[model samples]
Target: MGTKPKTRFGVIFEGAKRELFSVRELDNGDLSIFFKAPPFYDFLDGRSEKTLEHRYSFHRSLNSTPPAITLMRTVALEGGQIIRTSQLRWRAGESFSTMVFARACPTLRPEHYIMKERPKDTVILLYPIDIGRTTLFYHVVVTDTSLDPVIFRRSGLWVTSETFGHFKLVVLSGFFLILPFHRGFVSHAMTSKMRVDGQEIGADLPPIDLGNVSPERLLIDIGRMTTLLAEGLAERHISYIREQRYAERFVTETRQLLSLRPVPTPPDLPRR
Candidate 1:
């Protein structure tokens, strides 16, 4: 065993665990990852004819929601350290407008929130979570896990799970987590309180008033809250192990599996 050859591994989500993609480690030590969209996946609707790059554009043209999902996945893959994400709107005649939210963080920082607003287009929120921050989220109902595998589960009050680095989250039943609300944008929810787990982490936390805030601002605040928690969890464990590399050998080894894998071809989406 010369040098014990460094091996590449990836963590698969429960849904994508099936062979919907291929992973190749390149000779230059980067991975070439190819992902095929499965049938009935929302991203495939109406945009099947588009290439990967154009598909992003096509999806952005119709709805801003799908691309945000993509960005969130990308952020998670990058260990949840997201500085900014862009939202683009397609205007008539193929014209596009873009909004950029940016932030610069200093090293060894404490938890804080910063807001920058551009009345017409952009709104920037920067909230950085310190290391070892843990938040315990409360949910009112204890339903089955069918809602979303990435977030909720059916287990009778499971303790907590790790996502990225130091973002450790625990969900409790009969308790609802109250998220911030931006005025005139976000629909109201039966409000509840969310607390941090340890005294050293989330002591004397302020309450979130969902009554009168802008939608963009609320989004930034919630996003920052989530980012900080996920960062804390990422610090706790090594979750994202796969990096992009082109591996000729991996392609050869998994060729049969790739060949037999059924790529999803969803029916044409309904005309908008």
Candidate 2:
């Protein structure tokens, strides 16, 4: 709330990091944050795994001529999963249950209700982030007209403690349904602890040190964004509720009219 948070932007291409970026190396054979390629990987591991430590190998290749460091948040689960504000079905509006659901689904669903299947270039309107000095493309081309939703595992957000972001305009190419992507953060101190307990091999810079995460300064910004989104969702829910109530009221108001207007009789049919 007081001062601005520091941030920088970079794209992470999971697993394909070495295949995409030209990792930087120091004279002593250590990797620097800068790279000539995109990065892929999550930041906060689901169970605190070494998803980030292994990224050091991206620089070890020395020959990896395509990418940059990976900073992933929530990893994808088995099948298609997403964090979405849209409820697939009617909600009971139970308070406790809503909070529980929100806790599990922190991010919005990447399932975009976009175009009818076609080869087109779509843009990810990056909010709270600016891709400066990087060659990453904001436009994602959907080349396949008849294919499943393409998960761009090769590109991920360079999340930082000082930044918070959301893609206002989004698409996963072919299919709107995409795999689950959890978004969360890991404490720097906890990450250090992971290294000593026979884990976190090939130590290197923390994500903050790497300068990959891009976010707006001030934690308050994130809170504000969350509040705005919640309020918008609440308004929509209320509107739906009103629609349902209106229908119920209309039925009640017309019931007496229907009852008084009549019981039709089948007169004159006896002539037949």
Model 1, runs deviating above 4 Å: 1-210, 238-272
Q: Quantify how close model 2 is to the true structure by its C-alpha RMSD in Å.
A: 23.6
- Lowest summed lDDT across 10 adjacent residues in model 2 is found at 95-104
Summarize candidate 2's per-residue lDDT along 3-81 as a digit string, tens digits.
2221222222221111111122244433222111111333244432222221211122223332222221122222322
RMSD after CA superposition, every candidate: 24.9, 23.6
Q: Write the per-residue lDDT of candidate 1 for residues 73-144, one digit (tens) a residue.
A: 111122222211222222212312111111111111111111111233221111111111112221211111
**Candidate 2 Cα outliers beyond 4 Å, as residue runs:** 1-69, 73-216, 245-272
* Cα lDDT, all candidates: 0.23, 0.23
CA error at residue 14 for candidate 1, angstroms: 4.5
Each model's TM-score?
0.17, 0.19
